[model samples]
Target: MSYLLTAPEMVATAATDLDGIAAALYAANAAAAGPTTGLLAAAEDEVSRAIATLFGAFGQEYQAVVTHAAEFHTEFTQALAAAANAYAQAEATTCSALNTFETQLQALLAPLLPNAGAGAINPPSITSIGAQVAFIMGGTGIPDPDPMYVTGAQTLFIQPRFPGFLSDALHTPEQFWPTTPNLGNLTFGRSVAEGVATLSNALTTQFSTLGNSAVVYGYSQSAVIATIEIRHLMAQVTPPSPSDLGFVLTGNPNNPNGGVLQRFTGLYVPVLDVLFNGATPPDSPYPTVIYTNQYDGTGNFPQYPLNLLADLNAVIGIVDGTHFYVGLPPDQVANAVHLPTSPGYTGNTDYFLGLTQKLPLTSLIRPIPYVGTPLAELVQPDLRVLVDLGYSDYGPGLSYADIPTPASFLSVPNPFAVSYYLAKGAAQGVQASLVNLGWLPPSYIPTGYPYAPSVAPGLNFFVGQPSVTGLSLLTGALGTAARDLGWIPPWWD
Candidate 1:
């Protein structure tokens, strides 16, 4: 027996290219029609007339042949395009049917299968090609009304919401993580541990199968589980090769630089049952991609916690729903910034930083009627500069492991740039405030010192150097007064 494999998208693209070629040929043939088919006699003589007549007949014959060829080309192109569409539709239908069948089968078999329930692992159906991909869903506590279980009689009622973005990204069948998704303080650790075990077992089983190869995708809490699994795999004496196994993680809490876990390493909150699990292994041999969204408190936390403003902003980001990647546009996710890895780093891990256009702080403030948006615009740029200082910018060939410590207290790597931004921010703030107060016309374009002029209108503002400097001094004075009055903690720095 033999099977055929086809990529409908590739076929469609090929058809489009062929259609363009056909169009070009048709135009060329049309242009040549008049000159070739209706040739004029060079001279009013027998010889010229005879020659012209002969060539004209040949031209007409050639044109007829071309017409037949063009007709065939059109038919072929149309058939190819139709075939592509049919294939695409068939694939979609097949995937849908398979998923539905799997769900039905699991429900039917539940009663007969012992210990087969929500936590039961579904073994991968190995293909002749020997490679497979699995998608592990993120954590959630919501109970599913339409429950699909691996076993009967035992109902866990713990089915998490499946993210559409993950489905779009991974065009494959999904494998549910066999763990409780509840984030309640008492259950969080146990749920995570179960997830880790389930994933590890599934991967191990897949690897043990003859000629089997696999790639696993993990999101959110499952990403943490994946990280632990990767560590476990690496620790094995005969670990699977990069070619055999790979990993993809999104919104990973174990992200090296910005992960909340890495930021507060070794810290344990008694009631919360949250332990900073430390960073994912950057030196792992298996292929991996870790994606972190900017200002997502779990994945992208501020390095300097002492910067209270930045800390507050990060918290607001999490609260404002930046942590969720549910409805993010695919293009935005695709266009994530590729973060540079450390020099001499032999690890197969790559990091991507998803940029957030609207500051999370702005989202937090933009709901207070008329004043909300304008006030957010007025203060965002200046506040952005201050908040940004909390993060250490890694240039080319730098490690993600440069974790910030309390010893680097209030460290300003470049005082000049800081001073310049402070002045620029102050200027922008003043201009934005004036605009909000109706002192400046809406059409009046203010200078965007720290950013581009093409940035959103209200986001750009400017003021004089003297005023900016005065404002900076005033801010400093206020800070000093707060500290002296014991309003600011002594050990905060």
Candidate 2:
């Protein structure tokens, strides 16, 4: 990615530019000292002119004048150094001024959308199969206008709200976790779980008339929340609904607990815990696909800890059931899962499988003897763990591109800074203007368990894949929904 600003080019360019200015100043100072050179050269003229009048007297005088010229030369050299110093100072000032201007320009022009907000809705009728989606935005702290504004069009109808947190927290290396326990006393890794729950509850009552296939997608923390909520949603349905696709947690929460915030929360949930209901609500057996960015942070699950490869090989078919390695078979996945706005395919099935079902990163060490024989026997030898691209603090890469206009101003860093306030005022101002609108039918809750995979090929198959697109996933999904509803798309994107 072009994200590695640490490369030498920028530094070299800045250094060379400053040097060029200094050299120019030195040349200019030398030119300014041209009068001294002329005077020295004129010695012959002065001697010639003086000899015609008072030759002997002028000889001593001219010699004395010539002798004093060395002092002038010394002064001239000093002036050259002074000129160079001044040039350097001027260059420094110019750089500082430019930096200040850029910072202010970004502040004034830096598009920042609100991270999260709520608005009253006038329900749209669902009239088609394509419109049956229940667009669920992913986890915490992503502002409006962010890239993830166009997620989940096939499932739920959505208008993304701002997440209200810094983009760096989602993508940076700083590790911070919430104080509360998530699900089964396990400390959830990121902030989106709460946001998802909040958003889901708000929509639950309003969306009862929407369809059954609740497609939740969000990158980073939002993904984690979507996964948890899908479990909850599945549990709420009797025998579960057929439409529940669960969560598409792009950038699988870093292995072990996943996500940068794992360590702070102090909750140690194993990767195996996700497959079963240990402490969370009605246990969810629904289908979920966790997507990971190949170039994600070192906390990236499959490559985590030094012994990752050996550990998986050693844990293969262990007794604790904690280390059973498996991969999602292609038959189980829908086009919706494979064909989102962006798709990443490794082409190596075994490698994809290893990453998809590999164990989560944890501090706990499992002994070889304690593993259950059945769990050990079930381990697949063909599993291919994802290729680790080394650790990175920059999460999955997504940054603002091309400067924007009202189209641009809206793209500023925090537009939703005003969303809460604007939503309160514009609530009524925007209602009467809509002309034509598209709608889908309300959902028919399907019978049977929603948690199980829709297609069961055999014990040889698993169908979930992990892909990471960072926080843009949620922002993009929500943005698409907001545009559909006729709101000015927030500028943060």
Among these predicted structures, which one has the highest TM-score? Answer: 1
Report, for every candidate in turn, its global Cα lDDT versus the true structure.
0.57, 0.30
For model 1, the run of ten residues with the poorest summed lDDT? 150-159
Residue 288 miss distance in model 1 (angstroms)? 0.7
Residues 304-359, model 1: lDDT tens digits? 56678878888887768676654466576667766655445556777777777557
Give the number of the best model, judged by lDDT.
Answer: 1
The TM-score obtained by model 1 is 0.54
How high is the lDDT of residue 276 in model 2?
11
Candidates in order, TM-scores: namely 0.54, 0.27
lDDT of 1: 0.57
Instruction: Put down candidate 2 lDDT per residue, 372-397, tens digits, no spaces.
Output: 32222122111121111111111011
User: Model 1 residue 326 lDDT?
Assistant: 42
